[model samples]
Target chain A: MRQLIDLFVSFFKIGLFTFGGGYAMLPMLQREIVEKHKWATEDDVLDYYAIGQCTPGIIAVNTATFVGVKLAGALGGAVSTVAVVSPSLIIITIISTILRNFAEYAVVQHAFAGIRVAVAALVVVSVAKLFKKGVKDVLGYVIFAVSLLLVFFLDVSPIWVVLAAIAIGVGKALKAGKGGEQA
Target chain B: MIYLCLCWEFFKTGLFSIGGGLATLPFLSEMGSKFGWFTQEELANMLAVSESTPGPIGINMATYVGNTVGGVLGGVLATFALVLPSYLVILLVAKVMERFQNNRFVQSSMTTLRPASVGMVGAAILGVLQSVLVNMDAVRAMAWSQMLSWPNLVLFAILLALYAKFNKLHPVVILAIGAVVGIVCKL
Candidate 1:
């Protein structure tokens, strides 16, 4: 019971301080979970991050679940997951409620217009970084271009695109395996 | 019914939105249009708010949208549903934790999925540009000069330059600067 409460408080702090997105939570995770708590080693955190990226759901939440399960059990995972998002739920609910009421104000509208531009600028940077980080070779470039076309032009659902990528990846791996065996 | 739809949409987002929080943007854009729950402008607003606040952007977005749709219960439900898949998948992975990361299939899938995720986010930039930089109504009416929102474009350029120069400024500070500029310049 005490362990569960500790998991909740620790993750709640993580969620509270994590600004921007899941990636921003890494430093906090390192500081608290690794240095402070000694719950997992640095390599363990990295492994969890790798698993979190590939798995479904938000990366931060996935990481929280992984660490939570490691520390306690399934119940710990649940507790941590809920704790991590509690801050977001409470804070956003308040902001959304207030914003909805004031959305009609001229000042609010103007602020949002400017805010949107900033957000777009930030996203442009993020997408550029993502491309640089992810698109490593010819095959990666091809998948990226095709995926962009499919999503932007054809309006294909992203889930289908992800599934197709998985199939292609598995096929490529199997072909490599066959070649290795023969060689 | 709306609550059910919200659950399903967010659940699917959680299950398939690989990469991170930003990866969920494309799906949220689709959901906004499909359900008439929010407009493009509203989505932009949500993105700004999500960025400025604490926690993961995906969770922040889910709670915001859910709150907009069905009050507090909706917010709670949406957030819970979004985390549900992760909760279950993590539990399963925990039991078999040792071999899971070394498995060949997960590695290959992740390699391919990475680029694909970037592509989706790339597509999302276009949507953001359309809503923030260009006035579609003006374009539809063939008002050439009026089609572009110069103030927004100028603000975008300035922010981009600032980001390029600083390279380490916090996003919240940049967002605050944007709001101050917006009110002063009447953007």
Candidate 2:
């Protein structure tokens, strides 16, 4: 009960306040999970983030579930998931209802324009962090550069990039097999 | 039927956007153009709000996009779509956790995907930058004089410096700081 309420309140706060997306959500997650609630240690949260990245679901939600389940159980997972999404549900409902008029206000537009730059800046900063942490070797760096070029210059779908990497990896091994060798 | 379309769109998002939600920026931009379901500004607004909100960025974006198209139902459909692939993949992996945990194919595939994910994220960044920064004739005109204007550069510098210096700061602080910077720049 208290645990569930806490989950809801924490996630509602997260849903209500986080801006600029996943990377931007980190500091908040750190504060709530590590500082406020002590649900996860900084190291544990960092590990959760890494696993969050490799996993398919949304990073924040997955992190919530991971923490919730770790703390409680299946019920905790559901409770936290609801908690995280609850604010979004409420906020979006309001936005949907009043959206027709929200777009026309000059003050609103100006605020938004400012927010855009801020969002971009946050993302750029977060990407630099991810790169520093994840890009371990020369091959990793080269791969990063290539993906950037493909997505930016060519507007290629990232799905294809993953597919191509899988092929290159598997194909190289197959070729090595023909030559009677293994790594 | 609508749910299926929602699933397909998000399945595409999940299957690719390997680096995460930011990696989907370009594709979402294109979707804005294709479906006319969301305007460019609206999508930016969504990105901003979604950033501040709880849940996943991809899920947040999907909810925004879906709601714009089909209300609460649409939002639910879109969220489901986005999670469908991950749920299936994770479930399968969970079921088969022991047999292939150390398989070379799996190891190498992950290695390869890491770089690939970075490229996808980089591309996403480029696409978003182009969309946001280079609006219309000014971009095409290539006016070098204003390109590196001191004030714009200063704002960029302050923004970057602040982020690097305080990466742990709440995003709202960053936004508030940017607004102040914008007002200062204008004056």
Candidate 3:
């Protein structure tokens, strides 16, 4: 019970402060759980991040639950998951109640303008970081560029892009593709 | 019957929404069109609240849309349905994860997933831009030059510079800056 409480509080803090969503939360997760608390290791966090990415739902929430479960068990996972999400849930609930009427108010309207731009900036920063970290080789770079264009210019369905990429990846693998660029 | 529909839609969403919450947007847009269960405008409102407030944008949307359509029970049901598959799949994968996690096939699949996810995120961002960037009808009514708002351009530059300088800064910090700028500029 005490361990679960600790897990919950730590995750709650993660949920409250984390900006830029799941991927942005990775370093912080590393710091708190792996470095500070010793609740988990660096590899654990990375594994969680990878799994979180491939799986559905929000990466941060999924990650918190994964770590919590790994560290403690079912109770730990539940506590941590809820702890991390409660802030956003409560805040959104309140915002929803107010937003229906207050959204177009002059002040709100003005505030959102700056907010939107900043969010765009944050997105751009994240994209750049992810590109650097994930796209190391020529093939990866090519895929990234092609994917971006397909989405931006062609307006193709995302599912198709994912499927096509999978086919290419599998094709490369079958051909014994060797190199940093293979994947 | 309704719950089944929710389950199916959210299940498919979870399976294909490999990137993250925002990736679900295009799917939601299509679902809205197909089901006639919600409107695009409502979905936008859901997004605004979802992003501003809480958990995953995807989770919040599921709850919001679900609850909006079917009450509290619906929200809970939908939320669970959306996350259920991922949890199960992850739990199973976690078992053999260490052994095969970095295997070539795994890497290749992930590599494939990377671009796909990027495309989805990019598409969602574009969707947001279309809605938030300018008033569409006004742009159509007037010339392109008049539609070019100086505030957005300057704000974009400021953010770009700040981001470049503060490479290590958290994304939330920029979000905070955006909020402050939002209030000040009345944009």
Candidate 4:
């Protein structure tokens, strides 16, 4: 019971504080889940992040679920997922109810204008960090460039990009094995 | 009926929007037009609010749209539906994860996925840049001088420079500063 509450409280804080998006939640998750609670190690968090990217859901929520299940069980998973989303539900409910015509307000618009700029910067920072960690090889760089162009210019679906990348990885592995046998 | 439809749509969104919360934007836009729950302008507002608020943007969006379409009940239902997929998927993965944690195929696939995820994030950055910094309608109308939002561009550059220099400032502080500047300058 104490563990469940701890999971809920920790993830609730993560949900409440993280701003930009799922990626933006990483630092908070690292601090609380990894450093404070010691629920998961840094490597575990990174592994969850990788798995979360491939899975079909919000990355933060997926990570919470993974950690939760690891700590407790299915019930822990349910609690953490709910805890993570609770802040969004409550805040959005309040905003939607109180400010029905949210856009018509000038102050809100200006605030959002400023927030949007910051959000863009946040996204750029996340992209730079991911690029540094991800592009370790020539093939990785090529894949990054190709996928970026494909999504940005051609409006390709990200799922297809991920699928193609998986195929390339498998194909490369097969080719390497063949070369190893020949040598 | 409204509740049911909301659940179904959000469930589909949860099932398909891989990568992260922002990936759901296109689907939400489509839902906006299809359901008439919110206008395109309203969707933009929701995106803004979702960004500034705590929690995953996609879940916030689901709640917002659901509340708009149905009610508080709708909001609850939509949020549950959205997360249901992740709960199930993670549970299943947890079972197999121990066995396959170091499988060659899995490792290679994850390796490739790293770059692909970076690309997706890059695309998301472009989308945000377009929405935040550029006014497409102005560009479409050939109002060349009005295409870029100068104030926003300037603000973005400042923040980018600050981040580049400091590199460790918490994002929340930057957002708070942005809000203050926005309110004071009314930009």
Candidate 5:
């Protein structure tokens, strides 16, 4: 029971504090799950993050669930997931109810305009961080450049981009295996 | 019936929107047109609200759409439905991941996926920049005077400078500054 509550409280804090999106939650996740709780190691968190990126649904929620299950069990997973999302549910409910027509106001419009620019900047920072971590080799850079152009210019679906990357990975692995056997 | 439909729609969204929360934008835009749940402008507003609010943007959006469609209960159902797939899939992966943590196939795939996900994030940044900085439609419509979105550009420049100077400042602080600047400048 204490474990479940811990899971809930930890993830609840994560949900409440993290702005931007799943990627923005990484530093907070590391601090809480890795340093504070010792629920997972840094490598464990990074692995969860990698898996979370490949999976469907929100990466933050997925990471929460993965860590929750690691700490307790299925029930812990449910608790953590619920806890992490609870803040969003409560906050959005309040906004939707109280500020239904707030966006129409000129002040609100200007606020959003500024917020949008800030958000873009935040995303720019995230992209720079991700590039540093992900672009390790020539092949990685090629994949990054190609996928960026495809999605940005052609408006190709990201799902297809991910799928193509997986295929490329598997194909390279198979070729390497064959060459090793021959050697 | 409405609740069921909301669950089904969001479930599909959760099941398919890989990469991250922003990956769901295209799907949400489609939902806006298909379901008539909200107009395009409202969807844009929801995106802004989701960004400013805590928690994942995708989950916030699911709740927003649910509330719009069927009220509070609808919001609850949609959020649950959206997260359900993630819960199940992550559980299964957690079980299998320990066994395959060092598998060559898994490692290789992760190698490729890392860069791919980064690229997707790059696309997400570009999308945000286009929407926030450039009024492409207005420009295309030949409203040349309105093309630059000067206020947003100025705010973006100031914030970028601040970020460059104080590299470790928390994002919420920057966001708060942006909000204050917005209201003060009335931009």
Candidate 6:
């Protein structure tokens, strides 16, 4: 019982401080989950990060679940996931309700205009980073190009694109067998 | 019924939005138009607002949309639905922890998934840029000269330059600067 509360409070703090999305939360995660609590090691956190990246849902949520499961059990996972997102639920509910009322003001509109531009700029930066990190080899480039064309030009669902990639990945893996890295 | 609908929508989003929070953007945009929950312009506004606040962007969006559609209970339910898949999948992985990491099957899928996810993000941001930076109504009216939003573009450029120069600056600070500049320049 005490462990559960500790998990809740620790993850709540992590969630509260996580500004600018999931990656920005990494340092706080390292502090709380690794250094402070010692619930998981550095390698364990990194492994969770890797698994989180490939798995469905938000990486932060997945990572929190992984740690929670490690600490207690399925119940811990449930508690931690809820704890991590509680801040978002509460804070955004307040902000959105307020914004819905204030959004009609000309000043608010102008402010959002600037904010939108800034958001786009930041997304562009992320795209650059992702492209650099992910598109390394010929197969990777091909996968990226195909995914881009399908999602952009055809307006296909991203889920289908991801599924197709998985099939292609598995096929490549089967073909290679245990003969070292394919890429 | 609306709660169930919200649950299903966000459940699908959670199950498929691989990579991270921003990956949910494409699904949310589709949901917005399909359900008539929000407009593209409204989505862009929400994205800006979500990024500026604390916690995960995807969860923030789910809570916001659910609240708008159903209520506070709806918000909680939607977030739970969005998290359900991750919980189950992580649990399964944790059970098979020893073999999961070194497994070639997982490795290969992850390699391809990485680039594919990035491509999806690239596509998703294109839609956002259209809504935020381009004057689509002007383009639809065939006014070529008025297709771009110049003030927004100028602000975007300045922010991008600032980010490049001071890469360590916090996002909240950058957004605050944007709000201030908007008021001062009347953008």
Cand. 2: chain B TM-score: 0.79
lDDT of 5: 0.81
Superior candidate under DockQ, 1 versus 4? 1
Ranking by DockQ: 1, 6, 5, 4, 3, 2
Model 3 lDDT tens row, B40-90: 446655665565553556667777777666655666677667666666666
In terms of lDDT, which candidate is strongest? 1
TM-score of each: 0.97, 0.75, 0.75, 0.77, 0.81, 0.94
Model 3 pairs whose backbones collide: A88-B54, A110-B186, A110-B187, A111-B182
lDDT of every model, 2 decimals: 0.89, 0.66, 0.69, 0.80, 0.81, 0.86
- Which parts of model 4 are misplaced by more than 4 Å? A1-56, A70-72, A177-183, B1-48, B56-58, B61-74
How far off is residue B136 in model 6, in Å? Answer: 1.6
> Looking at candidate 1, what is the lDDT of residue A169?
86
- Sort by lDDT, top down from the best: 1, 6, 5, 4, 3, 2
Tell me how each candidate scores on DockQ against the true complex: 0.82, 0.38, 0.40, 0.53, 0.57, 0.74
Better of 1 and 5 by lDDT: 1
lDDT of 5 by residue, B1-187 (tens): 8899999888877876666677666556556666788865466557667877888888898898899888999999999999999999988888898655666776787788778778876765666677778888888999988997888898888888787678888766677787778788886
Backbone clashes in candidate 4 total 0
2 or 5, greater by lDDT: 5
Error of 2 at B43 (Å): 3.3
RMSD of 6: 2.2
Worst 10 residues of 5 chain B by lDDT: B39-48
Task: List model 5 lDDT by residue over A82-158, tens digit each.
Answer: 99999999999889887666757888877766676776666577668668977899999999999888877887766
Per-residue C-alpha lDDT of model 6 across residues A1-183, encoded as one tens digit per residue: 999999999999988888756787788889998999899998889888878887899988998999999999999999999999999998988898898889789899888877777878888887888889888999999988888788877888888988898998898898898555555
List model 1 lDDT by residue over A119-166, tens digit each.
888888878888898989888998999988898888899989989999
Q: In model 5 chain A, where is the ten-residue run with the lowest total lDDT?
A: A118-127
Off by over 4 Å in 1: none
